[model samples]
Target: MTARRADRAGRALAQGLALALALAVVSPACAAEADPANDYPTEARADYVFACMAANGQTREALHKCACSQDVLATILPYDKYVEAETVLSMRQGVGLTANVFRNAARFDDVVADLRRAQAEAEIRCF
Candidate 1:
């Protein structure tokens, strides 16, 4: 179970990174001037929230969403890789992911890193 959880966590992190990169590349169809990834900060927040959810055992959907044969933890790592892993799992709206995932020092750091990267991508490509 530990191994499986670690594998799942690794997968979730990769998907989050991929999602970040993809979101960065693909501008929204509706807006030409506005950056899709930063239009509302939802993606960054969602990234953190979903990761928190996965870590806290709130949901396992991210396991399915982030399926990969190879371990992808390093490729998708932020400071709070574990918390981000948890956050990326449960992701829901009208609730909170930052609050759920930010119970640790490392987790909070990872959120900041992830948010910064996402924000940068939004500015460089989307904007």
Candidate 2:
């Protein structure tokens, strides 16, 4: 490799190291914000919904808002147990809401009931 290229790489590394050190020293005040896990009520809720929706493979466009709404619902109900109780697969992207999965309404209702019950439990627990 060219000496100039090596020297430039070394300088970049050094600059990165210096920036890291500076951040460590100057970021305490920023880090002083309450920890979500222990200090904030909504943080854990948001985290839970985000994780659950991600696991269920909700659409990216809906994830943030869906997670937030789920978090609020979870406060009224426990989402964790609900998500745990059923098999949640990814919702098909671009599929209309009226798209039918099963031919039988009874069977589809059963599946929906299972999912809703899970959500209901989560809401109650979150509350």
Candidate 3:
């Protein structure tokens, strides 16, 4: 009977340790999810870094600077605003009446301006 009691205690300890380990693994992820300011998805950040590296050069220093730049921009601009600016810029690059609307619209210009301001801030902070 003593041996059986010892085995049950050991099993209980093991279960407690397993629960602790699971909490340790999940807590940081939960904290990150709760952070509202860091709403940019990993893929968006990666895409920005890749484009920045392409434009600035593919060196390790460029990679660091680009990542920093993206972080700064994330702080300065929300992901939805970033998407809006990118869409405007993309539409402006096309050769048609629709592109002209994007190019000439004041709201579109404001969106691009916000992105440019964010980029400028990022450049100052990161590069």
Give the top-scoring candidate (TM-score): 3
- Residues 1-85, candidate 2, lDDT per residue (tens digit)? 9999999999999999999999998775454354222222456556656776776567764566556556445444343434432
Q: Please give the CA lDDT of all the candidate structures.
A: 0.48, 0.54, 0.93
> What count of clashes does model 1 give?
17
Write the residue-wise lDDT of candidate 3 on 67-118 in tens digits: 9999899888988999999999999999989999998899898999999999
Ranking by TM-score: 3, 2, 1
> Global CA lDDT of candidate 1, please?
0.48
What's the TM for model 2? Answer: 0.27
For residue 85, give model 1's deviation from the true position in Å. 51
Off by over 4 Å in 1: 28-30, 33-127
- In terms of TM-score, how similar is model 3 to the real structure? 0.78
* Candidate whose lDDT is highest: 3
**Residue 88 accuracy (lDDT) in model 3:** 94
| TM-score on alpha carbons, each prediction | 0.23, 0.27, 0.78
User: What is the clash count of model 2?
Assistant: 17
- If ranked by lDDT, best first, what sequence of candidates would result? 3, 2, 1
In candidate 2, residue 14 scores what lDDT? 100
